[model samples]
Target: MRKNPVATKAPAEQVVKDIRRAMRKLHSSEEKIRIVLSGLRGEDSIAELCRKEGIAQSLYYSWSKDFLEAGKKRLAGDTARQASTGEV
Candidate 1:
């Protein structure tokens, strides 16, 4: 008789990792902007802000970099022309 693979138990470590991944919170774009802006305010250290926001410092820095880069690109007129409007 063949044993059922579906009845096999996953390793404990793998189960823990799966649970953690499943329970991880997903942040929205607006929430990311809010966290990034809070970090930039300078009232608190980035580490402190990250701790308060329940995120890692690396994640905060990445968001800040993206936000600033986007602003810089906008100021440089990278998207100045709309796709629907033909240039005169």
Candidate 2:
């Protein structure tokens, strides 16, 4: 049997709360991607990060892809609505 690491088991509620706090400050999809990666770095586990963030591995991967592509494709797409309506 594999032994579970003492530090590896994370409470679901705690993870959700932590992710929520990170989410509140993130306004753009780009920012969300950054926060998710930061969370992954802190935990260093995709499964663990997915569990805490209340999202599936697919979503995380999808978002990560968007984030990396954000540098080139994000600004114009990100501000379109705001610029059009003058919301930003």
Candidate 3:
């Protein structure tokens, strides 16, 4: 009996890595803000939300922290302004 040549399997590590890579989603700033806000709403547990979003809890926390910090700085009028150059 002849064996099938196309029945080979990839390495476990490589398969896992590929899945992780494929699972990564690129979100825009608006989408990120929406996600963070949803987490803050507390309608569901953080773990559940993370699972639904396919993201880690740590990532959600990081985004929340950055969003709050930016708001704080903006409220404090700490925004950066570009310097105007005068022609000589």
Residue 45 in model 3: lDDT: 93
* Per-model CA lDDT versus the true structure: 0.89, 0.68, 0.88
**Is candidate 1 or 3 superior in lDDT?**
1
Top TM-score prediction, candidate number: 1
Q: Can you list the residue pairs that collide in candidate 1?
A: none
- Write model 3 residue lDDT over 1-88, tens digit each, in one string: 7666455444666789999899889989998998899999999998998999888899999999999999999999999867768632
Deviation (Å) of 48 in candidate 2: 0.2
- RMSD vs true structure, all candidates: 5.6, 12.5, 6.2
Put down candidate 2 lDDT per residue, 1-88, tens digits, no spaces: 7777655656766799898888863347655666567765775688877776667788777777776676556655754333545654
Residue 80 Cα positional deviation in candidate 1, in Å, after optimal superposition: 7.1
Residue range with the least summed lDDT across 10 consecutive positions in model 3: 3-12
lDDT of each residue in 1-88, candidate 1, tens digit only = 9887666655766899999999999999999999998888899999889999999999999999999999999999897655655654
* Model 3 residue 34 CA deviation in Å: 0.5
